[model samples]
Target: MNEEKNKGGMMSVIAALGANVLVAISKFIGFAISGSAAMLNESIHSIVDCGNEILLLVGNKQAAAKVSDKHPFGQARAKYFYSLVVAMMLFFAGGALGVMEATEKLFHPEHNVENTWLVMGILVFGLIVETVSLRVAIKEIKALNKDGLSLYRFLRESRHSEILIIFAEDSCAVLGLLIALGGTLLSHFTNNPF
Candidate 1:
């Protein structure tokens, strides 16, 4: 069971790294081309995602270390602590900053944000990458549950904060992407910068 948990953690970390890299690149290119505050927000979000993935990788590595006499339960809980910090960072740094910038844009409606088809293309690519990453994470979780651990109970009581944090980050990423897409299209069609 422990081995399976370790494998799941490793898989999740790898998936996160891949997704963050792709999303970061796509958001950066979109921001460069369009100069949209929304895209800039997404770019910053992706940067945070990249950093979080690195932290998760570190946590996973540490958690997998062999247990010593002093700590028999091992370092698995460290991954959870690390993941919690990542979640807090995303909430404050990515989501809050985006909202503040968007509010400022609302106050100054004249600030133009150029739009191009390239941004749309990049967003579509990002969606695909994120979806793939999410699927991989799901698979890892399923594998971890093969030992008769009730799925719902496991999710409810999992002490690994990294799992929760990753889920939160991915959920936020997907929601933010959808909102960005809608806002970008609305702005392009109506020429309104909101």
Candidate 2:
């Protein structure tokens, strides 16, 4: 049963990583084609996603470590700690930094030199990738429920928090990407790349 649980969790992590990679590639294409600041922002966001996924995997592995004399209740809660770190990184490195630079850009302003098609393409790809991750996560959550577990109760007491962190980060990323795309289009229409 433990092995089966680990297998499913690992699969979900891999699926999330795959989606992030695909979206990252799309963002790179967006950057190469148009060089829009928003595209650059989106690219950075994807990069963070890639890195965060790795962190989540690490956290998951660590949390799964067998209990020993040195510690009890296993190392599962360590996953939450690491995932909290990831959330901090996202909040500070991804969102805060991006917002700061974007504000500066707003003040100074520049021409929209990015291709809308590229931005749109990347946005679409990101949406799809996030959707896949979300789907897999939901499936896992459902399985947990089928086993006579309440989703909320599980989250409150689960040893592995990678799933929750993955969901939160991916959802945040999707929203951020959408906002970036909207800003890009608004700039394109208003002819202000700021």
Index of the highest-TM-score prediction? 1
Scanning candidate 2 in windows of ten residues, the lowest lDDT window is 3-12
Q: What is the lDDT of residue 142 in candidate 1?
A: 68
Would you list the C-alpha lDDT of every candidate in the order shown? Answer: 0.72, 0.73
- All candidates: CA RMSD (Å): 2.9, 3.1
Q: Residues 144-177, candidate 2, lDDT per residue (tens digit)?
A: 5545667777666665566777666666767866
Model 1 stretches with alpha carbons more than 4 Å out:
35-41, 68-74, 147-154
| lDDT per residue as tens, model 1, 1-194 | 67666656566667877898888887887788777666676677777778888888787788888889988878877777777777787778766876887787778764465554677677778877877776776676666665567756766776555665665566666676677678768877888766
Report the Cα lDDT for residue 171, model 2. 68
User: What would you estimate as the lDDT of candidate 2?
Assistant: 0.73
Report clash pairs, candidate 2: none
Model 1 RMSD, rounded to 1 decimal = 2.9
- After superposition, the stretches of candidate 2 with alpha carbons farther than 4 Å from their true spots are 4-9, 67-74, 147-158, 189-194
